[model samples]
Target: MTTTYRVTLRNRNGVPLDVAEDEPIYAAALRAGIQLPIACNYGGCITCAAKLITGHVRQPKGTALNRRQSQAGFILLCVARPTCDCVLDVGVESHRGLYQNPFAIAGNRYPPDA
Candidate 1:
C-alpha cells in the first residue's frame, strides 16, 4: 500500500488548501484550481514563500531560503514536498512581520545578514 499525508496551506484570508505529500504545495494548489502567489517554480523567487506551521517537508536544495530562514520554519511551496502532514502559511501577511528584509519576506532574494 502507498502512504500519503495531508497538507493544509493557508493564505492571508485564512483560506486553506489541501495538498498531497508527494506533490509540491504550489502544484497541489494549482491542481485544485486555487491561485497562489508564485513566480519561479524553481525556488529562485520568494513569491511562493510560506511558513511551515506544522509537520515536515523535503525542500529542494536550490530553495532560496537560508539556514536561518529554514530554521525559522520558512519553506518554498514551489519546491517543498511534504514529508508528512503539514500546515503552511502563505504570503507576506502570513509571516506576521517576523522577517524584515523585503527579499526574504517576499521569498525572492536572500539577505546577506541572514
Candidate 2:
C-alpha cells in the first residue's frame, strides 16, 4: 500500500510536496524543486531543521535527535517523515537576512538557449 501525507508549510510559497512512505523529507523536497537547505543529509547536521507547527513525524530507525528540540517543535526534514497531516514553519530567522539582499545575486547574462 502507498502512503500519502498532508504537509502544510509556513507560506504560500512553501507549498508541500509528496513523499513516499520510505523517502526522506529532504529527498522529497529536492524532487519537487523546493530547495530546502541541507548540508549533511544525515542527522548529524541540523541545517535542514524545520518546526512542525502541527502533526506528528516518524524518524528513521537508529537516528539520534535531542528531546528538547523535539519538544520545542524542531525537526530535521532531512530525516523526518510525517505520521499525520502536518504543518511546518520552515526558513529559520537566521537566514532571513540573506533573503533581504537585492544585489547579492547576479544572474547569468547569456541566454541558456543561445
Candidate 3:
C-alpha cells in the first residue's frame, strides 16, 4: 500500500491533508479542492512556495531556493513531497518581502547566495 502522510495547512484554518509519499504537496492540494498559487511546475520558481513548520519533506527538483533559505524551512510546494506528517504556512508566494525568499533577500538573481 502507498504510504500517505497528513499535512496541516496553517493558513487554511488548520485544514488537514493526506498526501502520498510520491505525490507533490501542490498536486495533493489541488486534488483536495484547495487552490494554491502556482507557476512553473518544474520547481524553478517560488510561485508556490510555503514554509514547512513541522515534519520533513524532500524536494530534489526544487532548485529555486538557495541552501540557506531552504535550510530555514522554506519549501516549494509544487515539488516537495512529505516524508511524514507536517504543517505548512501556505500562500506565502504573494508575500514577497514577508519571508526570506531569494528575490526578497538575496537580490534578483537566478542562483542566489547560499
Best by lDDT: 3
Q: lDDT of each prediction vs. the true structure?
A: 0.72, 0.66, 0.83
RMSD to true structure for each model, in Å? 5.5, 12.5, 4.5
* lDDT of model 2 at position 59: 75
lDDT of 3 by residue, 1-114 (tens): 899999999888889999999999999999999999899987998888888889999987788876666766788999999999999989954344334454564565434323
lDDT of 1 by residue, 39-103 (tens): 88888867787888899888775458767677778788888887877777876765553466565
Q: Model 1: what TM-score?
A: 0.72
Instruction: Give Cα distance to truth, residue 63, candidate 2, Å.
Output: 5.0
Question: Residue pairs in steric clash, candidate 1?
Answer: 46-107, 46-108
Report clash pairs, candidate 3: none
lDDT of 1 at 64: 80
Per-residue lDDT tens digits for candidate 2, residues 1-114, read 979786766654558776766667777778877777787887777777777778888777414345545556677888888777788777664232212232533463222211
Each prediction's number of clashing residue pairs: 2, 0, 0
